[model samples]
Structure formats: structure tokens, C-alpha cells
Target: MYIPELYKNENQEDIQNFIHQNGFAILVNQTDGKLWATHIPLVLDVNADGKQVLVGHISKLNPQGESFKADDSVLAIFSGAHSYISSSWYDHENVPTWNYLAVHVYGNVKIYTHEQAVNSLKKLVDKYEANSENPVRVEKLSEKTMREARGIIAFEIEITSIEAQKNYPKTEMIKTIKISFPN
Candidate 1:
């Protein structure tokens, strides 16, 4: 991640908020000399000891389930709303660019047990069902579904480092705007 100093954001709260808002992330790791990626929704969790962790699951059938190992480095990427910023939007001449918010979480992967996998699924259900008119509780899941869910591989990532950026050349942008519109 080549982050320019002007675009880097080191605010922990902001990073956490962004991750919560956009929980769906891309988990990447290397396996068999190849880079493998999995798209999954991870819940940001704080343990009793105040340690941060990311919890998610992947299908047992997926090779990534076998690829991930304890303490192996992983990268989870969360991308927020983004749009093309046309150069024409500026009064001054500039190149067209894209503006977006992105957070990169680097961590060590730890696989969870069957019981923990079920709990992780329940927690996800509880989170998303909070605002629904008729929330579908995980407890109501059928025995068959629960059985199948147990076949999934649950994992946690203990975040080691996090880097975030809101893509905008702030200083240059402000100066360019002033030049474009002198009032």
C-alpha cells in the first residue's frame, strides 16, 4: 500500500468506525507460492482483555480453509464508498482521479474450533439483525443448517497493524481550489 503522507489517517477511532461500517473485506494470504484471497464479512471484536480481533468464516471446501495457519500473516482489506472525481469538478486544471476510503488490516490468523465457529455465526446474525423489522435469530436455525454451518472453518485475526487512508491530496487540492476560484 503506497500511501501518501497527506492521505494517511492514523486515528484509531476512525479506522474502527470504517471497519464496522464496512465489515465485508477481502482476506489475502499466500499458500503454495500463490496468493489466495477470500471475500468475507468479519466482525470487529474486543475481548475481555481489551485486545482487538477480527472473526469470520470460510467454507470448509475452500482451499483457504486449509491454507490459513496459526500466526500466519494475513491482510484484510476493507473498501468504503468511492467515486470518480472528474478533473472538471475543479476550477483549476488537474488530472481526473478517484476519491475513496480504504482500510488495510494486517494480522496473524488463528483458526477457531467448531463451537467457536457457531458462536461467530451467531454474533454476525445478532449484529445485522438488530435493525431488521423481523430479525432472523441464529437460534432459530434448523438442525440441518446448523450442521452444515459447523462444516465451515471459523478463524480470527489478531490485528497487528492497521493503515487507513481517505484518498485526497488535501494540501494540493486546497491550493488548487484557491487558485481556481479567487474571491
Candidate 2:
């Protein structure tokens, strides 16, 4: 992710929280000399060693995951709300541009096998389903069946670096520019 100084987000906690709030992300990897991308909901897993990992699953029929290996690097791009600001919106005659917020995470995609994928799924349920009022139901499958169903391979992306960028276009021509994130 190429972030200009004006659009850079420097806070680690803020970036992490932003991703959490916008967990639905686009995971990108390389395949056949081309970039493969998939949209998936992911959960963050933090380890004691400060090793931050991301867990997510893709359908067995999906070809996007084929681009990655245990040591291959992957990129997850998260997007938030965005809108177009018209020049007329400002009091002055300013050039129109778009305003948006986004974050891109770089990591190593470590493929999780049978047990590891199950653990990752459990953790994902805890993170996403635990908030519901009713108890979440998870299907239990035999090891052999699970292994066969592993067509949808789950993986843990150990985050190597995070690059968050906030784009705030200059709109002083009409309305006052206000950019603030909760403290």
C-alpha cells in the first residue's frame, strides 16, 4: 500500500480497531503471475509474543487461495465508508474529490491443517458468534470428514506490517475541514 504522509495512520491500536470494525476484507495474493483477490470475513488473533495473526476461510471451490503457500506473503485490504465531496459542498469553488478510509495489512499466510483449522474456526466463532443472544451452533464432523471438507483450507496470516491510510481531501473552499478520531 502506497500511503502518502498526508494519508498515513500511525497508531497501532487505532489501525487494529479499524480493521476489527471493518472485518470484511479483501485478501490478495499472487497466482500464475497474476493477482488473486477474495472477499472474506476475518478475525484477529493476538499471541503472547506480539505475533498478530489473522484467521479466515474460503470456499473449496474458490480459486483465490491457490496463490498462497505457507511462506507466501498476502495482503488484506479493509475499507470503510466513502463519499464524494462536490466542489459546491464547500463555500468556495474547489476541485471535487473523493473522501475515504482504508487499511492494508501485510502478512505471511501459514496454511492451517485439520486440527489447526478447527481451532481457528473455534476462535472465529468465539469472536464473531459469542456476541449473539442465542448460543451459536457449530457442526461436529469426524476427523476424516473434516479432512475431506478441508477443501476450504483455513489459514493464519501472521502480520508482518500494517499500513493504514486516512484520506481527507482539502475542502476549505466551502465548509470547514474537520478530521478527528475518538481519543
Candidate 3:
């Protein structure tokens, strides 16, 4: 994520909100000399030590699951609204660009224990099902249904760094034109 100073967003509140709003993210890592990516729902969580972490699960059968080692680094990318801005829309000559909001989280992986995984799943379900007419609670699920949790790998990423970028053409043009067309 190349974040020019002008477009870089360092506000923790904004970044956290973006991740929460766009919980479904692309998790990327390398496994066995090859790159693998999985689109999964990741929720922001605070670890016991009070550090922010991203929590999610993937099928145990997914090869990417094997890539989750304590020392291994992974990237979670959350993307928001984006659109192409034609140069013709600008008042001055300019190249076409895209306006978008994105956050890149880099962290080390931590595979959760069965108990921890279950708790994570419960939190995830509770978060998303809050507004449903008939909300589904993980605790209310039958044993048979809960057993299915065994088939998944739940983990958390201990956030090492976060890079957020918000690129709007109008905002960028103000900075650009100031430098390009000085009075």
C-alpha cells in the first residue's frame, strides 16, 4: 500500500471504523513458496493485552490455513467505495485517476485454540446478527451444528502496522493545483 503523505489517513478512529464497516477483507499470505488469498470476514478485536487484532476463520481444508504460523506475516486488505475519475472532469489537464478508501493491515498470525476459536466465532455471529428479526446465537445452536466448528481454523492477526488511504480527486487536486499553478 503506497500511501502518499497527502492521501494517508492516520486517524485511528477512522481506520478502525473503516475496518468495521468493511469487515470482509482479502487475507493474503504465502504458503510453500506460493501466494494464497482468501476473502473472509474479519472483525476487529482487542486482545487480552489490550492490543488490536483481526479475528476470523477459514475452512480447515483451505490450504491457506496451513500458512498461519506464529512467525508468518499476513496482510488483510479492506476496500471501500471506489470509482474511476476521468481527467475530463478536472478543470485543468490531468491524468485519469481513481478515488477510493482502503486500509492495509500487516501482522503476525496466531492460530487460536479450540476454545478461543469458539469464542471468536460467537463474537463474529453476534456482531453480524444483531439487527436480524430473528437473530441466530451461537450458544443457541444445537450440538450437531456446533460440531461443524471443528471444520474451521480460527485465528487472529496481531497487528504490527496499519496503513490507511483515502483518495478523493477533489482533495488531491487542491494539493496538486496549488503546486502546479502558483499565482
TM-score of each: 0.87, 0.81, 0.91
Error of 3 at 86 (Å): 1.3
Best by lDDT: 3
Per-residue lDDT of model 3, residues 26-101, tens digit only: 9999977788899999999999999999999999999888877523699999998776666766667889777778
Pairs that collide in candidate 3 are: none
| Candidate 2: 10-residue stretch with minimal lDDT | 174-183
Q: What are the lDDT scores of the predictions, listed in order?
A: 0.83, 0.76, 0.86
C-alpha lDDT of candidate 3 relative to the true structure: 0.86
Superposed by TM-score, candidate 3 places the C-alpha of residue 47 at a distance from the truth, in angstroms, of: 0.6
Cα lDDT tens digits for candidate 1, 113-142: 888888889999999999999999889989
Tens digits of per-residue lDDT for model 2 on 50-131? 7888889887677666666523888999998776766667876679877778888898887777777777777776677767
Candidate 2 wrongly placed segments (more than 4 Å) = 137-149, 167-183
The deviation in Å at residue 151 for candidate 3 is 0.7
Q: After TM-score superposition, what is the CA distance of residue 133 in candidate 2 from its true location, in Å? A: 2.9
lDDT-wise, the better of 1 and 2 is 1
Candidate 1 matches the true fold with a TM-score of: 0.87
Q: Where is model 3 poorest over a 10-residue stretch in terms of lDDT?
A: 174-183
